[model samples]
Target chain A: MALPHAIMTALLEDDMSGYELAKAFDVSVGLFWRSSHQQIYQELHKLADRGWLQCATVAQAGKPDKILYTLTEEGRDAMAEWVLGESRVQEGKDDLYVKLYNLSEDNANHLTAEISRRREHMMQRLYLYEKIRRRHYANPVSLPVRRKGVFLALLAGIRQGEQFLAWCDEALAMLGTIDEPVE
Target chain B: MALPHAIMTALLEDDMSGYELAKAFDVSVGLFWRSSHQQIYQELHKLADRGWLQCATVAQAGKPDKILYTLTEEGRDAMAEWVLGESRVQEGKDDLYVKLYNLSEDNANHLTAEISRRREHMMQRLYLYEKIRRRHYANPVSLPVRRKGVFLALLAGIRQGEQFLAWCDEALAMLGTIDEPVE
Candidate 1:
């Protein structure tokens, strides 16, 4: 359900071939709304069937026909109406927390190592988010209305990424207090 | 798969009837790892079938027999091995982000109001998380090994709750800059 809306939001940028949209999703939209390429293609067909998207096939002289999708008026109305609706707080089902709940002195090292691995992943993502911020959001407060929405979404990612990384460091420190020296 | 592990983690505190486990999950463990009561009951059956849990039926006079589940030695082994493994960062699929991406002056109020509602919900959760921190973690650094894990998990909730609230405020501020006053 969210995936269809996610695809529609991406189409707000411009009409895109399914392949181009998938690429765009991976590079940007996927950062906020994770969707597999296959899911995107499948949703594209469904959206077109529902008349949320208008699809066209363009023949080429020397290449295979290109399929493109554009948001229909109905799609824009759907997206607009959706904006007014309540959004569920997508609670993260972090297995790490469940793993931590089972922790004892005997297995502390394993969870600690896992936290370190997670920290690296968080660090790399924080770096990517910041890069996007610097490149696109110099004056986010001044961007046009729709662009401001994009900036706000990116800001959500940056703030959460920073906090998540900080929590990793804090978790390691707390674990250190009770960690036994390896023999 | 995670629900099974999540159930095992809950059982670490004590063996419980499925009813008690479901209640416990709703109040505490569900905060970290969310699952429906139906899903929890289903996973309990699956785990018992896999020999990770032992289900015993104890008869009560003039009442239905109570079915209790205890983590087996194999369950402990599974939990231990699972702790060493990697955990995926459960990136929240926040539809608000997609809604934001479609922002325009016409629909600005709709999204702005949606954010306000989200902020209130987030504030209430943050307050609850803080309440738990105060009640259990008087001296987090000195807690026993296993208890330290519990504190850390709660700290994750507290930390993320605070950050999400901050982001909501920042988002509103950014939106405020361009919002047209309704006549």
Candidate 2:
């Protein structure tokens, strides 16, 4: 349900073909809300049917025609309403944490590898977020008013990644000290 | 589903009736993996069917018999296998951050209230986590080897909540200075 709203927000930025939207999603909206290409395509049809989006076919000189989607007035209004409405706090369902909670000496070696893998993953995300911050928000005070909120959301992601990395370090240190049982 | 796995973890800690499990979930397992009472009951039945759990009925004075669930050998094996396997990193889907990304002067006032509400909620959780830490992990170094992993997971939750609260503070500070358009 919220996918349509996320799509509307992306379309508000620029009208694009489904291919462009999927690529853009991987970088931006998808950072917060993940959806598969198939799901995105399906939602596009539903949104077009509901009149929230209008699609236009553009024929290329050497390629097949592509459909570009843009938001309608209703879609814009709906987005505005959603912004002003109450937000739901999403429940956390981190499988890594669950694994940690159930970890035993028998599986300590396996978990140590997983912790390292997760730390590397968090490091990559942190690097990406920092890159975004440097590129878009080097001078936060000079940013346009419209971009300030976007910057805030990015900051949240950056902070989350940093905190998680710190926790991973602590976990690795603790795991290193615990003696693995001798076979 | 992960629900069954989470259920198994809770049951591993202590065998309890369906009602007791539900209440325990709200306080403990629910922190990491959320599920409704109905969903818990449904999964319980499925787990029993899968031979991962066994139920025993015990009659109580002035009350109907209650069925208590305990993990079987197969369930233990499943949990151990799951722990050793790769953990899927859950995608973050925070509605507040989405709204923040799309916020405009028109909806700024509404988002301000939401940020405050979320900060208060985070504060409550922080307090509860602190209480648990004091009661159970005041001396973490002295904790049993088996409990070290659980302590680490709780530490993760505490750190995440703290970081989220800090982000909420930053958001409120930024929103306060933005000039709202005069209606």
Candidate 3:
């Protein structure tokens, strides 16, 4: 699906071996898309077979040679077509919301604990987003055209994390007031 | 995987025929978890075979008999267990972000139109969520224990939609200022 296109974009920025691509995915592309290294490697092979990507083998001293992947002319054209195509709204499936919808009074404590744990994770992500914003987009008003889209995406992530943290506080406060029946 | 759980949650609330369940899914459960009617029907059959659900054939006036699905005791227990278990964070895969990340200067007009289209959809969702909040959760503080969880989930949806709309506005504003080169 989009994974192939995502890989193409990453390669367009710079060619890298499979190992480097996996590491880059973990830090950057993985934020919006989650993929295992095994999946990435499989897709790389498929892209090469489809003539969308070219591979160059680099010999290393006393080690196995690494294959670097780069987007071919066909790959770049495909990405351009995709960028101009219509996109459907992404519907995200969240199990936590399903659990919340079905939660009974008996599971109040568990739900509260889950909310707290999720809040901690959101806070950590928020901190990281803020750090990136300050470092890369300190002056949003004068951002280069190429970087504006990226800055906007980061903004969306930061706001989403903040909204989640706020919801966690609201849920915790409401749950605190409900008196649990002593078993 | 979560579809089975989502179906169980819906059936727990009320017994419904397959057609009815499909319609209800579009308006309610579909907000957090989306499933096609074919997939829902397939899962319904699997759930019945697994003894997690029981189906009864009911006669209707001037129509063929319909099978209605209800949750069994085993199904309820399974749902309870799932509710209390730890849930991993849901990673949302947005293709729009991928497109934005790779967009070249030549595609600025297309990206702008796509952003506008997405914003309109988000606005409509925000309106619907607000209407639901006003009608169902008018006084959330005085809600029954069972309804409180649903209310919180609704609040989360409303806030998320609002955050998305806000981000869309910011993106639009930034995109408007960039002048595309004439071909």
Candidate 4:
């Protein structure tokens, strides 16, 4: 329900500054739970206030001092407990589905174009996830306990992406054969 | 972002009272796009005020007259234009992914139990979708333009549900083999 719990999992690996954390989320953690720079910084402060995350200032010779965020023991405890808690399964909102739901002979061609564009986009994302898998999780089955979680999480996205591409293919093919409406 | 467009698509099939519209959403339209009853009712009023939907009163001898909603030409125009408009592809938020991301030796078993429960739940949903497929979309290949859209929309949810079950299986299998944390 909250971003702190997700952020704690992101911080489990190593200490990171707010900027670094934002970047990390943009690449990995953000894939599941999205957060903005302002949001991550705000939550970081709130977590530190709750004694869940400890913040330390690292001096930089040529720039402003960097505040690094480290997950506290309390943070890890909170994350571990949250991990085992009952969570809701979400039905995600996709506008493409809305278009498809309203598909008619009139808009079939237009909708298929949009779907084709989406297919390309999904493929790019799959490529990115595959690159991540190869570079980071080359051997998922043999990964240690700590590392396995990240691999599986990324795998979830990869599987969804693959499934999405298939759906797009199914849609495009079906829409391609629609006859013009009899006016 | 607005539910009105999606609700308009639902009303395109037949004129229905707010109650009927809500029920229709629960069964079919709510797969990719979800809406609460209150939200649906509110959006219906907004669409009527916008002159996109017409509300007609039908009297019942035994009960209060029901106001049924029908999509106007303007509503069709709106939905048509909106369908052709560019929209974002979303990465949905799923808590299971977060839990899997945090998976470690300590919580592996507990997490897998939750995942197993989710797997069963997903199977139930798949069964329901399959029933819908059999009852309605028996011949997807030959469906008319008006009907094909609904079939494809339902197909998207089925595909995603199938992909989710696969992800759950992957997570459970991996977590099942995790080694205890070295103290």
Best of the candidates, lDDT: 2
Residues A1-183 of candidate 2: C-alpha lDDT, one tens digit per residue: 467888787888899888889999877777888888898898999999999899999999998899999999988888898888777878898777777778778877888898888889879988988898998899877776658888898899999999998998998888877778888
Instruction: Write down the RMSD of all candidates, one decimal each.
Output: 2.3, 1.3, 1.5, 2.5
All candidates' TM-scores? Answer: 0.92, 0.97, 0.96, 0.91
Model 3 lDDT tens row, B1-183: 589998988887799988899888765767889888899999999999999999999999998889999999999998899898989888768988877777557887898899889988888887888888888899998988867887888888888988888888888888888888877
Q: What is the per-residue lDDT of model 3 for residues A9-68, given as tens digits with 9 covering 90 to 100?
A: 778778988888988876565667778889899999999999999999999999899999
Q: Residue by residue across B54-152, what tens digits does model 1's lDDT show?
A: 999988899788899999999989988888777777776778888888887777777878888888987888888788788888888777778788888
Q: Is candidate 1 or candidate 2 better by TM-score?
A: 2
Please, what are the lDDT tens digits per residue for candidate 4 over residues A1-183? Answer: 847877887788878999989988867778888878999999999999999999889999998999998988888888888887788877668877777788777888788888898899889988989999999899987777767888888888898888988888888888878876688
lDDT of 4: 0.84
TM-score winner, 1 or 3: 3
Which parts of model 1 have CA positions greater than 4 angstroms off? A59-65, A180-183, B59-65, B180-183
Question: For each predicted model, how many residue pairs clash, with residues at least 3 apart or on different chains?
Answer: 0, 0, 0, 0
**What ranges in model 4 sit over 4 Å off?**
A61-64, A179-183, B57-65, B179-183
lDDT tens string, model 4, B82-172? 9878887676677777777777788877877888888998899899899999999998887777679889888888898898898888787
Q: Which residue ranges in model 2 land beyond 4 Å of their true spot?
A: none
Per-residue lDDT of A60-124 in model 1, one digit per residue for the tens? 79988879999999998988888777778777688888877777887788888888888898888
Which is superior by TM-score, 1 or 4? 1
